[model samples]
Structures are given as C-alpha cells and as structure tokens.
Target: MIQAQAIRLFTNRGYDAVTVADVAEAAGVSAMTVYRHFPTKEDLVLIEQPARLIAERVAASSATQPLVLRVGGALVDAARALTGGDGDAPEASERFLLDCLRLMVSTPALRARHLDSQYALQQAIVDALGVDTTDPDAAFRAQAATSACLAVMHTALTRWAQDDGQTKLPALIERALTASFGDVATGQGD
Candidate 1:
C-alpha cells in the first residue's frame, strides 16, 4: 500500500520534488516506516512484484521447453498476472501504469534504477537456465532474450497508454511477444 501510494505521489510530483514525508503522509504512515520498507526514494517508486513474478515464472517453467519459448512464456504469464488475467489489474489502473512508465522514462535516477532492476532480472534468468555467466554464447542468449522481452513489454505498454478507449494490456503483450520471437521460433534467424 505504501509503495502504491508512493508511486502515485512520485508520478504526480517529480521524483526530486517528492519527499518521503509526502509519500508517508499519502500512505498514512510515518516517514520512518516508509524508509524502513524502502531504503531509498527510488525503491519506493520501483515496482518489485513484477520482477519477482518474472523470476518465479522462469524458475517454474519446464526445462524441456526451448529457452526462448520458456522466457517468452514466462513474460506473457507475468504480464497477464500483472494486468489481471481476466483484464482487470485490480488496484492498478491503466492510467497509473502509464504514469509509472512515464515517470521512469522522464526521471534519470529512476531510469538508472529501472535498468539496474532489469539487469538483476536478467541475472535471475541466467541463474534459472543454470548457465555460467562467463560463457559468451550462454550469457549473450540470456541477455538477448531478457532485453527482447523488455522491449516488447515497453512497446506494448506505450501503445496501451496512448490508446483512448479500453485497452487489453495482456493481449498487447502477447502480440508483442509473438512479433518479437516468432522468427526465432521458426529458426529462420536471430
């Protein structure tokens, strides 16, 4: 709840402008409590659940599946879960999601933090694949797959944010994943 409130506040007011006291007040908690949960203001605005879900899904996928397919499927599943499988997204509205994206894009500190989070996720994928990070091909494949997924997701979310009427984020994500990985699946080219 505090995190959600912090997102709303940070998105509305620029990151540098918003203080922990502001988020704490909005979340109805003490500033100390907010700091306890999130050591940094950037952490307050960053969404942790999505990354955790991605890690969990990747870890749970069948080993028999192609690495790309497993990674893509995991991403699709995470998108569905985040956007609400049936398309509701529970407490997070489309507007809020858009705001968060815009916030991340507009703020340098936030963007750096977001990139760090993504790098961590890619590492998790490498760990899940049981590949040595020092192996060039293995490392390249893991990083490429993770980067491709993130690109598709970002494009899908941007499209959804731009659309006026109701938009299905999960469907958009599925399409993005297909477009991004279809050629790879056919072994045509990388």
Candidate 2:
C-alpha cells in the first residue's frame, strides 16, 4: 500500500516533488513506517525481488554445466517467470512496471542507484554460483559471465520500455541472449 501510494505520488507529482512523508500520509502510515520498509527513496521504486529470483534460478542450475549455459538458462527462466507463461504481465502490472522503469531511467539519482543495484545483483549471482573469490581466475570468469547475462537483460528491458511495453519482454530477452551467446543461451547446447 505504501509503495503503491509512493508510485502514484511519484508518477503524478513527480519523484522529486513528493516526499516520504507525503507518501506515508497518502498510505495512512507514518514516515517511520515507510522508512522502515524502504531505507532510501529509490527503494520505494526499485524492487529487489527480480534479482533474488534470478539468483535462485541460477543456483538451481547444475553446477557442472558451463557458466554461460547455466547463467543464460537461468536468465531466460527468470524472464519467463517475471512476465508469466505467455510472456506478458497483467495489463495493470505491466503499466506499473513500465512506470517504474521510466522513473528509474529518467531520474538521474535513480539511474545511478540502478547501477549500484546491478552490482549487488552481480555479487548475488557470484555467490549463487558458489564461485570462490580467493581464486582470481574463477572470480573473473564468474563476474564476466554474470555481467554478460545482466547486460542482455538490461538491453532487453530498455527496448521493452522504449516500445512502451507493447512487445513481449521475454521474447526480447531470449532474442538478446541468443544473439550474445548463440543457441547455448536457449538451452539447446552448451
């Protein structure tokens, strides 16, 4: 409820124009309550669930598989899960997601924080893969694979937002991954 209020206010009143207290009041909660849930204003708009879901999917893949295959397959699976089976979120949900993406890309502060969130997500992927950072080569490989997969995701999402969410996001994601890593990305072969 707080987040919905925040997004409503942010979208209608502008992110800079609305304060946490405003959102709190709009949601019938105290400022402290809002702060307890979202440490930063950006957190009100940014969601961490996708990263967690992606990491979990990656971790569930067999460790014996090649890194690209594991990460790519996990990314594809995560993308599907995010948009639902038909590669489309409900109309209302898609609008909400697009609004959040627009806010993140348009706002300078949110753009910077989005990068930071990506770094944290990369670390989560590394940990999920159980890569030993003590081994420099392993760390480098894990980081590279994870970063590449994330890059594909970002590109697809950017395109999705640019198209005003008319295009199916999962298809865009699969296309980007396939272009970057070929058939291995589709789980056809390593």
Candidate 3:
C-alpha cells in the first residue's frame, strides 16, 4: 500500500526527492498515517518486518530440503513472494521490485540495509539448514552452499537490473542455480 507508493516515488523521483508527505499523498493517506506505520523516513524503506516474514515462510518448509536447494529455493521464494507473486500483474510486480532494488542501491542508508538484507538471508539459510558452523566440515559445506546460492542470486539481480528487466528474475535464478554448478567453487576445488 503505502510502502509500494513510497518505493515507486523513491525509485522514480530519488529517495531524497520524496518525503513522507509525498508518499502519503501518493498512497492516498495522511502524513500522520504514514508516520504511524513508519516511525522515520528511513523506516519507510528500511523496515525489516517483510524480510522477517519471508524468513519465517522459508523456514517453515525448507528444513527438509537439501542444502543447496534449500538455500537457493528460500531466497527465490522470498523474492517471488515479496514481488507480488501470481496475483499481481507480473510485469507491474517486476517493475515494482526493480524500483525497490534501485531505491536500495541508490541511497546510502538503504544500501547498508541491502547488505544487511543479504547477510540476514545468508544467516537464515545457515540457520534453516541447521548447518553447524562450529564443525569444520559442516562450516565449509554450509559456507559453500550458501555462497553458491547467493552468488547466483546476486548475479541474477545484477543482470536483471542492468537489462532493465528484460530477463525474468526467477528464470535468471533458475538458470544460474541449475546451469552452473561446476562454475561455483565448492571448497573441494582447492
């Protein structure tokens, strides 16, 4: 609702160019209402609730999946869920996600949050898989699996953004994860 409007404004107008009032108007709400939902302007873009929910959703069913599948699947599921899923128009949702990502990269505060988001995603993978990071073998495998998944995801994101969404993100993720297993370092390599 309000968040989508804010994302759109921030992406199109620049984060600095958009204010709470502007987002409010765009969302058809009052500034007070916007403030009630998001305490600070940064919160408008930096809130962790959505990410946490995605983590929870991933955690629910991913525990039984194999390491690599779980890590990559959870991230893909989160992105799919957050980007409007099958209900919303696919193209509009893709554009919206692109805007949200652009907003994150375009602003310093949001950029830090973006890094944090990646860390959290990785940690969530480690946790959901119950990878004992203290054990040498477990730690190595966990790190390799998560790194491979994240590398693919990050690559997909970069390409998706660069090509202006000519590429479907899920397709990119699928191709990256399935098509390049040999290319990803497995710690066994060296």
Candidate 1 RMSD computed on C-alpha atoms after optimal superposition onto the true structure: 3.5
TM-score for model 2?
0.92
Q: Which stretches of candidate 1 lie over 4 Å from their true place?
A: 88-96, 132-136, 183-190
What lDDT does the true structure give each of the candidates? 0.75, 0.86, 0.72
Q: Rank the candidates by TM-score, best first.
A: 2, 1, 3
Error of 3 at 51 (Å): 4.0
Clashing pairs in 3: none
Candidate 3 lDDT score relative to the true structure = 0.72
Q: How close is candidate 3 to the true structure, as a TM-score?
A: 0.75
The pairs that clash in candidate 2 are none
Expressed as tens digits, the lDDT of each residue in 52-115 for candidate 3 is 6545655675454566666666666776666655343556667777877667767898888788
Q: Pick the candidate with the highest TM-score.
A: 2
Q: What's model 1's TM-score?
A: 0.82
Error of 3 at 104 (Å): 1.7
Model 2, global lDDT = 0.86
lDDT of 1 at 165: 18
lDDT of 2 at 83: 64
lDDT of 2 by residue, 29-88 (tens): 999999999998999999787888889998999988888877877777776676664444
